[model samples]
Target: MTRPRRRVKLARIVNERKRKAALKRRKKALIKSLNTICVLCGAEACMVICDRTNNQGTHNKMVWPSKEQAEAMMSRFKSLPQEQREKKAVSNEMFLQSLLAKKSKKLESLRAKNNQMEMEEILHNFAIDPTSIEPATGKLTRLFLYINDLIAKIEENESMSQSATNVNLV
Candidate 1:
């Protein structure tokens, strides 16, 4: 059998100001309920309602380990053999270094892609327009100035790269 559609309760407040105030109060209560921490565990284990109901609904919070329990577990781990601890530390360091290197590579690739897109946009704007050569007034003058600046920058970059390559060879 097909399930019947659930009906939602309409707000009793008809006035605009009163309805807004009611909404604000309900929002504050919901936020407070969600931020509530459990007494048994130190974790924020408050349950949130996903239904269409206006009520905050039931709390089905999960009980996690308290701070004392976590500290005890850590102490047990620290009491392991010196060689094992060293191996664990070394592996953690290597893992962290590899993660950092991977992130750096991704950032470098994004930067290169951004630079290439900007260069292509500049080339498209400057090279595709033939009107800049016909006049020496207003927009044409500005375009010619921008193109000259871009040419100077390209020459400077080429010289810098050539110098760097020569230094690397030495």
Candidate 2:
């Protein structure tokens, strides 16, 4: 008979091998699922589903009749595999556009920062003493600053919206 220590070592090795094999099987299963195989019964050529219903052939089949039943089924499950999630397969055009939109947002923010800095420099250069303040001149400058700030905000929002637009990434 094997020594206890040797038997324990052998068991650990066997368990490790089983774990590795199971992981490999799981990877293959996920790949197969992404290719439209059903998760429940491993049925290929079946309806693509966000999550598989009980061992039923119809992948998207609901176990319960009403919303409560559906919610209960979903809540009972701990989690679904990433492949089983309803993630829209990534699209090339959307990916590229999102990349460009991110770039545009960065550029826009940089430009706004530079503009604000320049305005601050100009304001500092055209400094007026508070003690000798001209009411009319101060009011006119305040009005111009408010308008410029509003225009900047509008431009900022437009650039921000561009990023949102390319998100067909679902």
Candidate 3:
């Protein structure tokens, strides 16, 4: 079984050396992930990372898979309209924020669906035996309401179909 991932708290490392080491390690992992996705999906992608913190000022930027290919990709990107470029461009902070927003939205949706899913399970138990499960009064009411709503919808659909068939026959 796959182990649950440990959540890494996003915080700045106080120690400069450790911070630098972490940056290098994370950067390598990011590049690997990009390469893996590109190769797996057969995507044409150009990535440019500039390391201003590099000890050697001579080679501060790295481009993949090749400098020539990266330049060509960049040229195509530059040819796009300003609005198009702006729309596609996302800062690191913006990316994290948008990602967090999406996850939060999904989490809310899941939480909302939890009750419906639980009601379904309860209904399943009731199908086997009405006395199989003893839910709280409030829960039972909710379950009954859910069942009633479903039955009403089904009945409405059946009536509509019957009317349609009657009209066709006439």
Alpha-carbon lDDT of model 3: 0.87
Q: Where is model 2 more than 4 Å wrong at Cα?
A: 1-86, 128-143, 146-170
Q: Global lDDT of each model?
A: 0.64, 0.59, 0.87
Candidate 3 lDDT by residue in tens digits, 63-98: 878899998988998999999989968999999999
> Which of the two candidates, 2 or 3, achieves a greater lDDT against the reference?
3
Question: Which sections of candidate 1 miss by over 4 Å?
Answer: 1-75, 90-103, 130-170
Q: Estimated TM-score per prediction?
A: 0.27, 0.29, 0.50
Model 1 Cα lDDT, one tens digit per residue, 11-83 = 5777868776866676666656545644445543423333223346654332224456546656776798888
lDDT of 2 at 92: 91
What is the lDDT, from 0 to 100, of the residue 8 in candidate 2? 26
Which runs of model 3 end up more than 4 angstroms from their true locations?
1-5, 53-59, 80-154, 160-170
lDDT of 3 at 160: 100
Evaluate residue 168 in candidate 3 and report its C-alpha lDDT on the 0 to 100 scale: 100
